[model samples]
Target: MVPDPDLQLQMVIKALSETVSTAVDPGNKVAQEQLHLSIATLGMMRSRLPMTRRFYRALAQDALTLAKDLEEKTGQSGALTQAMNDVGQALTDPGIENEAIEQSRARLHEAITDHLAQIDKSLGTVARDIVMQGSLGSIERQRAWFVESGFEPNADRIPAISELIQTPDHP
Candidate 1:
């Protein structure tokens, strides 16, 4: 029987946790430390794997919001407009492949960056706020995913992974 992917990942994580906890050579501190790090990495990957599509979709939505805001400010209709349309189309496709979603997200982000560069110092408060909001949200979401890595001193402030992945922008 084919093992469910999520279940398989859980099994691997559990096994690795046990190995690092007990099976590693106690005298070999470096090996033990490396195994511990590996386990942590695996756990993080397991948490992120199922949410990849949702994460990308949410990013796409955020990019779309930023693009729309920038477009309104610049009043220019070209690459940004096309990028918005592309992302919108990607979001609407229930069975869209990961590659397509990533490509669309990248295009939208690039378009937003290019537009912002062109506007530079003239960007108004509203646009700056929108951009900052998106950036902070993305950073928080990433921190939430990597909290187990013991990197964030204020990890408590980070939203739960489920909360980040279940963004209102996507179903």
Candidate 2:
């Protein structure tokens, strides 16, 4: 999307490195620094995302609560657009070699996804938990849906959660 904001990503990593992971890993400290910076930059940009009142209700809650509270703010589009500019610039940070950062990012995602695939913990979708919990109260709705089809609302929840965990987060 948006022609791969390479520099912006680097900037964002440079921004976030300070907060996400700052350990002295054996693998490329320079890369780590750049990544952290980039993430921090993006986090800062994300702060301007309007933070709608709907979301405010769940501001102190966990991810699931937050997502469920999304009534969609009215004036966030401008903020998101500005954030894109910040992301673009961050992706193109010159402090860290852009080409090397790209390569490392690719490898990193591959490794992370590989690890996620092997994880078998039964934790259903984090952001969807509120919706699922809401459904739990509707036993009649569950039964009716079950009767109409060969699906059960109580089925396959853990697997769903595990997959949700696989979704990447900068933090």
Candidate 3:
């Protein structure tokens, strides 16, 4: 039987915590500091593990939307069509792995980027406007992902990462 990845992570975190508590010297500032950082890092990973699938799924959905919108506006096909088809296939798989979803999102995003470059070369500002508008939702979701880092001055104004991930449109 396959060990659940989430449970494996929890086991690792628990083992690390136990080792740090019993073996690490309290008076050794360097080891203690490293241990603290390691624990925090593990904690962050633990928090994010369950959301990985949802996050990638939503990102894949956003890419699909952007690709469809671009295709409609430009009346074009090629790489965009192929990327859309591939991602659509990936998204439809009920047991799709998170890594597969991430890979699909990356491929779709790359196609979108390449398409945008071509548009910039030929269509100029019009393409830029469409891309900017279409990409805002993705940009907002990425920003929400980092809200916990305390870098955003108006962090309180931003929606929680979970809220952003659970947006109605994505569901």
Candidate 4:
């Protein structure tokens, strides 16, 4: 059965609230777990949403706030920091580059590249082949798969990536 998107969004907000309330101790295992889980949940929600600029902005704002809170409490750089950076990079407007945003993106990109390399090493050839094969299909085919997998067909708006991913060659 399909899940209610509104309900899922509420759950994500509730999880974020709970994480904020219990996140006093940066080293606390429970708090760390909650924070990570909340982040993952938010990412999933963002992926499922119709990709309007407003939606992206809202998600970025929430993630930025959460990342700031985590940084303040932990006094260290980690996944939250990287997530914040990625959102910032992904949301940046063209021809209006900011130094801080650029720096954050660079750091996050480097970290993710390292992580992906580690995964590639660990998962070996079979996983790599599987991932490559999966990614080789057209976006329309992927959309069909999403529909088959029970995603709502009538997304409120076209995903922002549809516009952003287009290049002169493709267009």
Question: For candidate 1, lDDT tens digit of each residue in 97-157?
Answer: 9889989989888888777766657566666777887677666666787788888898788
Candidate 2, overall lDDT?
0.37
Instruction: Provide the global lDDT of candidate 4 against the true structure.
Output: 0.48
Cα lDDT, model 4, residue 30? 82
Q: TM-scores across all candidates?
A: 0.81, 0.20, 0.78, 0.25
Worst lDDT window (10 residues) for model 1?
Answer: 118-127
Q: Which segments of model 1 are wrong by more than 4 Å?
A: 19-30, 124-127
Higher-TM-score candidate of 1 and 3: 1
Task: Return whichever of 1 and 2 wins on TM-score.
Answer: 1
Higher TM-score: candidate 2 or 4?
4
- Number of colliding residue pairs in model 4: 0
Provide the lDDT at 8 for model 4: 71
Q: State which candidate has the highest TM-score.
A: 1
Model 4: C-alpha RMSD to truth?
Answer: 21.0
Candidate 3, 68-153: lDDT as tens digits: 98888766769889999989998788888889888888988898888877763666666777788888887878778766655789
lDDT of each: 0.79, 0.37, 0.79, 0.48
Could you report the Cα RMSD, in angstroms, for every candidate shown?
Answer: 2.6, 21.1, 3.1, 21.0
